[model samples]
Target: MQTRMIDKQWSEKYPGVGKGPVATEPCISPEYFERERELIFRRHWLNVGRVDEIPTAGKYFVRELEVCKVSVLVVRGNDDQVRAFHNVCPHRGNTLVLNERGTCPGRFGCGFHSWAFTPEGKLAFVPDEENFFDLDKSQYGLSAINCEVWEGFIFINLAPMPKQSLREFLGGVATQLDNSPFSEMKLLKTYKVEENANWKTGLDAQNELYHLPFQHRYTIGDSFLLKDGKYCRFSNVNLYNYHSVWSCEYNPAHKPLPTEALLNRMDSALTNIRFDKRISDFDWYLIFPNMALLLFTGPSGDFFMTYNFWPLSVDRCLWEMRYHFPPAENVGQRLAQEWTIGQLRDTLMEDAFQHEKIQKGLASRACSHMVMQDEEITIRHFHEVLECEMAKV
Candidate 1:
């Protein structure tokens, strides 16, 4: 058994931690997971992509969200405003924008009937214009979903009428990270993997730092837990509305692996790169249902990455990791960032490979409840939020 940190127990120190013996049914049950699809995923504000992906007029991309069983087409109009609509053609319901992303010029046309809709989602043309009666052009236009942008990130709500604006939903998260360089930073690269585990199961693994030293022992263990003889405690965990932020102690003196050490030692200039001027090396933010904003401060450019967990089924989810970095000024800078990326990839692969085994274990119904420690407060809070949202209907 791991040594439990009693003094740093957030569940007791903080009043909000939810009551739970975290259940396995929520991980493996199809019926209850369906309730999650209807009650939670559809109603929540879900992050889809960043504005940088579509910077010019008439640029658009189709995002297929399996959780809601709806494909969303996000567009940048001639007016330069970003918007989203159902990807289905308004007439025959044939899918629109077959390509993952492309420039629409002025509008997109369905391949089946050649019905074209403007970037602003207005019905522009149809080949057989004289066939139908009472065909109001305005009525036949593409249907729009509630779309909003925050800090250059695009979020789409499938709710017929969103309960609150994205600003209202994000609350203090906006104020806290308002100054982040999200608008200016560029996408360095993206890594994607499909996990055969419930979305929650995958997300739960990342909400805290307790597992870093053990699960990631070979790759990142020494960095988080130095030869120091003391247990490393998270600096603090702050909860807001339904979202939460957790910061952990970072050892500035933490040594790098042999390859990285050799690279940095060879080029002293690489040490000059700093991910951010933040106090902690890591600040992880969980946005309710499915978004994780993992901000970092490292020896390379100050940038933040995002983890998007898109559910495909009760026991399957598509997981994506996006890496954002400031443009590299020199070869040294690029190599430094690549070094970190390699380590992160290896670490995430470890976590990803284990998720399937966890799913299989949960399927066994080997245990009714999984006991959680004080360090796992965020996981408990996540389950609490899911239970609360699911109970609404």
Candidate 2:
């Protein structure tokens, strides 16, 4: 199929404000990936893990987004605050945390030189106390990054000084979800998958609903209205500097039977809950440079779920999906909601399979660029944001 160019009329109508040109070469270039690691991933506020993941003092989790060669340590301090530190030891630059996650016995000991650090990244001990003369323990502590938690998810920025705070980075997108039940939602399960594709390729596949009808037909195809879906409801797509939001309600014209039934059960189980089942919506918050946060509200108004993405490399990425439920819901209702997670999992597998094929295709010389349509405004906007950032580098 021939790739469709952005509508000239749309560009003329919005003139100077429409989507930018599509990037075909950069998407498949290894050289571009190297620059991306330096210009984008290293400087952005990357999502590490959730605050709930390390709930107790001394608890810690390591996030290895190796593309940028970044290994971050998310630790819960004695003061009950969560902090992120570079997982490298000061001496010989050995990795401080070897395991994915575990509880630190009051301090983290580097296996290399037995250097110990408090959960707050403060140096506490040295193996040979008298071995090194004039070695200042205070100056050799684990280096820390700017860390913050927003609505339960922990975020870290590697920049010595970030240009924008997490709150400022989130902007109005955070306010739109301020009334959401995310803060109270407990983490039920986490599913991680590594896709063999550029992080942008995986993100491009997710930023739009245009592919749902064609790509996920056997699964969620019937659940969403594709061509018939309205463009400006629930929340409108807003493109900021490097971030974008593609917000809309599920089209009422094509709500599937199973989805409708799920919505009814949701209402019956929750009190004082009212959702316009016909117009149930979700928002896809794309934190550019790299990251996609999918926020969904069930048709029954009983729960919310988020899919957080972290780019592992130029051609690899990791996704962490968490389901959230109300604190008041009974075990039976929560369990029923949990079952929905299975359906989501199936849909994700479907997406992953297609993304891998696209990656292979992009690697081939036969095909060059992909097409875009009005419904794919989200994906188009993403490329625009990426190109803008690349130009600055």
Candidate 3:
């Protein structure tokens, strides 16, 4: 492949995201992290999981939001409505739903006491009701949380009164991906890594194409189209209010490995899926606070991936990665899908190795700020958004 000439398009388009050094305090200071917990994580809409996880009535899953120290119970009720509630027993404040996920019976029973609640979160039974003094079971129903479904993803807001609905918080991102064929694909694999790094550090590294050629040199260094024979350039960049989408072109002349070439020759069902929701060959969207949606136009099919960075402390975070692909119909197709997972998993492992090293450098106080580049405009814009949100009183 040859080098192509390109201009500083993103910087020119998003001038308000100044081309200045971004401070490291937000990623290093313990006090700053505490502020983020209250002002950012507690207030924004956070994605817990998808509705498919609880497909049938009475099926539920529990998500622990360590940043806010809250456990969320997401379930499908007998009415077939998806709802969320705080996973805390209203009677004695004991943690409810100890398991990660389960199929609820007619009612949920607290193992500590004999209190029981319906799948609809209504208090159904309490031992020796006559002994209580004018107790109202209706008044002690499970504490509900603001939960909403978008496309198939479930989101919960911890705010007493959310400043904006999920649709409003998503802004332009929803408009662009309105009818995306996300439900057509099935989850293929999930990977979670506990990293010794700030949550933002991992997200910032993945948000830009500047490090693709260097950090991922062995795996996907040449996968994206490059400029000046060295740097990868974005085909398009859309900066939304509190969110952003970046698209890049793939190198058409790149060669495939032996297994990949063999799978391409086979009549694999992995190639049967396709959708028209792409802005370029690849699109990466940042759903504000801590989620990322990645769309890929692969040789076999169109697939998508998601990333969630959950903060555990000032210097520790959980990085979750999930891949979704078209359902396989035969053994060959399934093998091909597994191969696709392996390729991406290897590349991401390279990224996971760098996160800890980056955190160590930031903690050393050797550098007060990080210098930005034209291609790293998304990272700069993200920091700008973070600062604006943290400035709220």
Candidate 4:
């Protein structure tokens, strides 16, 4: 047998993360989900999008936060400030922006009564102003939400007064990942799928690498460093106060496909792109509640991706996947980027399929809790954090 220094390395490093099976009630219980929706999602800094999305003035987008039952409109005003407002007209309680996302006019006009609001969320006009009994537009601006930006990611808090600021809530996550080169990359591809599974179920599935070699065998089975030449193991792991991060080295012996070989010869393939921020070949961060930030080393340059699991119901969630990469300069580089995107896209599709089946299994109640190993410490720690947060009065 291959000699090893320590078994259960993660738990040994982080002793508070107990070694035990975690209850599945958080994944399948409707009552628990409601508590999570109020105590966890609404109170935390939920990442909505990136500042790059609204690069220019008058650009805006709308997001329907199903978990909190609110529609949010994120906009960039002419003053070059980004802001978010409730996507509802104050006049008749109608939706202010019907489109999913687009550039705003001088003012957003309500379809119901033609009430208009400026990009800054100020009420600009109301049709037949003189006909109103004593209407004051100053007091009728769009309802604003708590919005903040960190490392190019925009997060919104639904709490009337958040327990902590975005930076404070991020805790060590902010300090470790602060000043990352996220602004260097550009948006590449986006995919959204409405999965019939609890948000945590999907998030838990992606937070560990124990399933990488098994569930992703056909896609990225040998992509990570393995132990005893059979199982994957993390190169580094850090469990923060409210968030966690795990990183693993890429397998050096694995052979690339023919296409990848050709692409590498033409341009830098998905080889390591050295950066000061990268801790390993791959870094996966669970940004608490429902967002994941991933940084990957590519040959040409480094790239990043984000995963947002938005809860639709206790048993349903919307999974959003987005990729950002360095701008390709040549045709070969473009082709290589496309291949990289396709490779990851396929892998995530497999994950989406498995999430539903896992939900089904959890619904069956055959097992009340999920057994954990040293490799799956992140998932266990996540449930612990979930329980701790949900328990808050």
What are the models' TM-scores? 0.93, 0.86, 0.97, 0.96
**lDDT assessment of candidate 4:** 0.88
Candidates 2 and 4 compared by TM-score, better number: 4
For model 3, name the residue pairs that clash: none
The residue-by-residue lDDT of candidate 2 on 89-114, one tens digit each, is 98889988999999999889888878
Better of 2 and 3 by TM-score: 3
Ten-residue region with minimum lDDT total, candidate 2: 1-10
RMSD of 4: 2.3
Model 2 pairs in collision: none
Backbone clashes (count) for model 4: 1
Ranking by TM-score: 3, 4, 1, 2
**RMSD to native for every prediction?**
3.1, 4.7, 1.7, 2.3
lDDT string, candidate 4, 1-393, tens digits: 121325688888999888878998888888888788789988888999999999999999999999999999999999988898999999889988999989997899999989999999999998889998889899999999999989889999999999889999898888888888888788989999999999989999999988988999899898877887688888888999889999888888667999987886777534334457778878999999899999998778888999999999988999999999887877888888888899999999999999999999999999998889987898888888888988888
Winner on TM-score (1 vs 3): 3
**lDDT value for model 1:** 0.82
lDDT by residue (1-393, candidate 1, tens digit) is 122334646866677676568888998999988888889889999999999999999988889999888999999999999999999888988888889999996778899988889999999998888998868888888889889999899999999988889999898777688766766567898999999999988998888777777888788775653324344556667777778887765565667778888766543333333534343667788998899998786554466789999989989999999998777777876787788788899999999988888888988899888888767887888788888888887
Residue 328 of model 3, lDDT score: 78
Off by over 4 Å in 1: 1-6, 225-232, 265-279
Assess each prediction's global lDDT (C-alpha) against the native.
Answer: 0.82, 0.70, 0.88, 0.88
lDDT score for residue 265 of model 2: 63
